[model samples]
Target: EFLRNELEDSTPVIIMSTAGNESNVLNAFEMGAGDFVSKPVSPSELLVRVGKLLRQRAN
Candidate 1:
């Protein structure tokens, strides 16, 4: 609901979850998520994803 409500906002959202199912992922993207990451997250990968979103927003 928050994602849908804030769809027009400039700030990006990244969904992190242990339950990384296809349905949930698609739903999140459909609702305007910038990225999604599965749990047992790697610090480097998270940083890279965040950096990518930041760069995209900058453009």
Candidate 2:
């Protein structure tokens, strides 16, 4: 898998998708995504999530 092979462990993957279903969101989490944002995404919300992830990584 790309996450296992290509991505560094510290890198947080946030999936922004329009599907917004529980199954898809669960799949992303199972595959190592740090956070999931459903589409029609607000830029500010995305930024906040990104900031949270970054802060987590920093810690």
Candidate 3:
């Protein structure tokens, strides 16, 4: 529902989940997610991913 409403491509969506299976990751991408992070995320890694997305969005 959130994705459906936020399809204007302004806010980049990142999916973070414990159930990080292949199908789930694929589903997120198919639903317009900009990135996906699995459970037990490292702060630095998450920051990097977010920064990368933000940089891409800015460009």
What's the distance in Å from true for residue 40, model 1?
1.0
From the highest TM-score down, the ranking of the candidates is 1, 2, 3
Reference-based TM-score of each model? 0.87, 0.86, 0.85
Clashing pairs in 1: none
Highest TM-score model number: 1
lDDT of 1 by residue, 1-48 (tens): 474575557588899998899999998888788999999899999999
lDDT of 3 by residue, 1-59 (tens): 26555655458888999999999999888887889999989999999999999999999
Candidate 2 lDDT over 1-59, as tens digits, reads 38756764648889989998999999888888899998889999999999999999899
By summed lDDT, which 10 consecutive residues of candidate 1 come out lowest? 1-10
Q: Which ten residues in a row have the lowest lDDT in candidate 2?
A: 1-10
